[model samples]
Target: MNAPIIIGAGVAGLAAALAAAPRPVRLLTAGTLDAGAASLWAQGGIAAAIGADDSIDLHIADTLAAGDGLCDAAAVSRIITGGPLVIDSLRAHGVRFDAGLGLEAAHARRRISHVKDATGHAVTTALAAAVRAAPHVTIIEHARAVALDVAENRVRGLWAETAGGLVHLPAAAVLIATGGVGALWRHTSTPPGADGTGLALAARAGAVLRDLEFVQFHPTGLDSGATPMPLISEAVRGEGAILTDETGHRFTDELAPRDEVARAIVRHLAEGHRVRLDATHLGAGFAARFPTIDAACRAAGIDPARQPIPVRPVAHYHMGGIAVDARGRASVDGLYAAGEAACTGLHGANRLASNSLLEAFVTGTDAGTALAGEPDAAATTAPAAPPRRI
Candidate 1:
C-alpha cells in the first residue's frame, strides 16, 4: 500500500511526518529540508501561553484582536489552548528555547519562546532531525509537487517535478504544508520558492481557497535590495527599537499590530519620507540579542547598533490559503494542509506576531494524528467552505 505523501519540508510538514509515525510518510521538499523553508528565516520566535502571567484565554484574545475580527472563535480557542503542548512537544524533539519568555508587538504579556531570535531555525532543525531519524519517514529532497491527482472527488496522488523529470506519486493520503505565497509580491520577506504552489495545486484539485486578499505586510523588512528581503523582527521593537521617518520622528506606536505598523510605514514612504528602524539605542546588546538582524544589516552596509536600519513594508505572512478544519483537513477528501499554506482561521485579517510558528506546530500535529487513524476510513465530501468570514 502507498504511504501518505506530504508536500513541503518546513516545520508543518516535518511535524506531520513525525506525528504520522509508524505509518510510512513520503515528505517532499523543493530544496534541502532545512534550507529554503520560510521557517528558517523566521526570527520573532513562537508565541505560546507559557509565561507566568500568560493564559490560554489571554493568548486567544490577543490573537483575535490581531486577526481584526475575522478569526474563528472555536479555532482560536482550540489552537491557543494547545499552544503550551506544542511548545513542550518541540522541546521534547530537542529544540531549545530561551529559559525566559519575551514580549512581542501587540501581546499583552511576554509569552514568546525563542532561541536568541533564531527560533525558527532551532525548531526546524530539531524537527527535521527527528523526521530524518524516523524509520517510517522518507525525506525526498528537490521534489516539488506540481498538481494533485483527484478521482471521485478525492486526492489519489500528485504529479511532482523531480530530478528525473515529472513523476506521479500515488498515496493513500496527501498533506500540503507548502508554506505561504509571500514570494508573489516583489517586495517580500519570504524565500523565492514561497509562491503559493500548494494553494494553486489545492485549488486545481477543487479545494476551497480563503482570504487570498488579506496578505500580511510585515512592518520591519530590511530594504537591502535583496529579492526576498531580510526581516527585522518585531522582537526588536519589543526590546526598544523604534520606527522613524526621514526626520527621525516617531509616527506610529512601534508595538502596534502588523497591519497598523506596515500601513504607517507605507504612508510615510508615500509622503516622501523614508521609514527607518532605529535600534541604535540597543548599542552592543543588539548584536547579542539579534545576531541575525545585526549581521543582515551589516551585510547591507548598515549597522543596527550604530545607525537606523532602512525598512519598508514587505509581504511577510499570508493570513489566508487553502482553508482547513481544526484537524487541518481540507474540504476535499484525502487532502490536508497546515502551516502558512493552510488557513484554519486562527489568523483572520492580520496575524499576531510569532503566532505563525505556533499555528504551524499545532495544526501540523493535529493533521498528522487525524491521518494516522484508520487507513480505510471514509473521507468527508463537503464542498470547500471556510468558516464564515467576519
Candidate 2:
C-alpha cells in the first residue's frame, strides 16, 4: 500500500511527517527541504503560554483580540491550550529555545519562546533533522505538486512536477502544508514559491477556500529592493524601538496591531514621508538580541545599531486558506491541510505575531495523527457542504 502523501516542507509538513510515526509517509517539497520554506525565514519566536505571569486564557484572549472578532473561539482555545505541549515537543526533538520568554506586539504578557531571533530557522532545522532520521518517512525534494487527483468527490492522489519529469503518486490521504500566498503580492516577506499553489490545488480538488482577502501585511519590512523584502522583527519594536517619519518625528505607535501599523506606514508613504524603524536607542544590545536582523540590515548596507532602518509594509501572512476542521480535515475526503495552507479559523482576519508557528504545530500534529489511523486504501466518500466563505 502507498504511504500518505504530504506536500510542502515547511514546519507543518515536517511536523505532520513526524506525527505519523510508524506509518509510512512521503514528504514532498518544491525546493530543497529548507530552501523555499518561509518557516526558515521567520525571525519572531513561537508564542506559548509558558511565562509565570501567563495563562492559556490570557493567550486565547490576546489571539481573539488580534483576530478582529472573526476568529473561531473553539479553535483558538484548542491551539492556544496546546501551546506548551508544542514547545515541549520541539525541545524533545533537540530544538533549544532561549532561557526565558520574550514579548511581542499585541500580547498582554511575555510568552514567546525563541532561539535568539531566528526561532523559525532553529525549529525547522531541528525538525528536518528528525524527519531525515525517521525510518518511515521518505522525502522527495524538488517536487512541486501541480494538481490533485480527485474522483467521485474524493482525492485519489496528486501529480507533481519533478526535475526528471511529471509523475503521478498514489496515496491513501493527501495533506497540503504549503505555506501561504504572500508571494502573489508585489512586496512580500515570503519565498517566491509561496504563490498559493496549495490553495489552488485544493480548490481544484473541490476543497473550499475561506477568507481569501484577509492577507496580513507586516509593517517594517526593510525597503532594500530585495525580491522578497527582509522583515524587521516585531520583537525589535517590543524591545523599545520606535517608528519615525523622514522628518525624525515619531508617528504611529510601534507596538500597534500589525494591520494598523502596516496601514499607518502606507499612509506615511502616501504623504511622501519615508517611514523608518529607529532602533538606535537599543544600543549594542540590538545586535546581541537580534543577530538575524542585524545581519540582514548590514547586508543591505545599513547598520541598525547606529541608524534607523528604512521600512515599509509588505505582505507577510494569509489569515485565510483551505477551510478545515480543528483536526485539519478539509471539505473533501482523503484530503487535509495544515499550517499556513490550511485555514482552521484560528487566525481569522488578522494573525497575532508568532501565533502562526503555534497553529502550524498544533494543526499539523492533529492532521498527521488522524491520517495515520485511517486505512491505507479506504474508499473515498463525498464530503458535506463546504464551510462558508467570510
- Which candidate should be chosen as best, given TM-score against the real structure? 2
Tens-digit lDDT string for candidate 1 (9-38): 888988898999778888999999769899
Cα-based lDDT for every prediction: 0.88, 0.89
Reference-based lDDT, residue 206, model 1: 87
TM-score of candidate 2 against the unseen true structure: 0.96
What are the RMSDs of all candidates, in order? Answer: 4.7, 3.9
Q: Provide the TM-score for each candidate, comma-separated.
A: 0.95, 0.96
258-361 in candidate 2: lDDT tens per residue? Answer: 99999989998999999999999888988999998999999999999999999999999998899999789999998999999999989889999999999988
lDDT of 2 at 115: 93
Runs off by more than 4 Å, candidate 1:
374-390
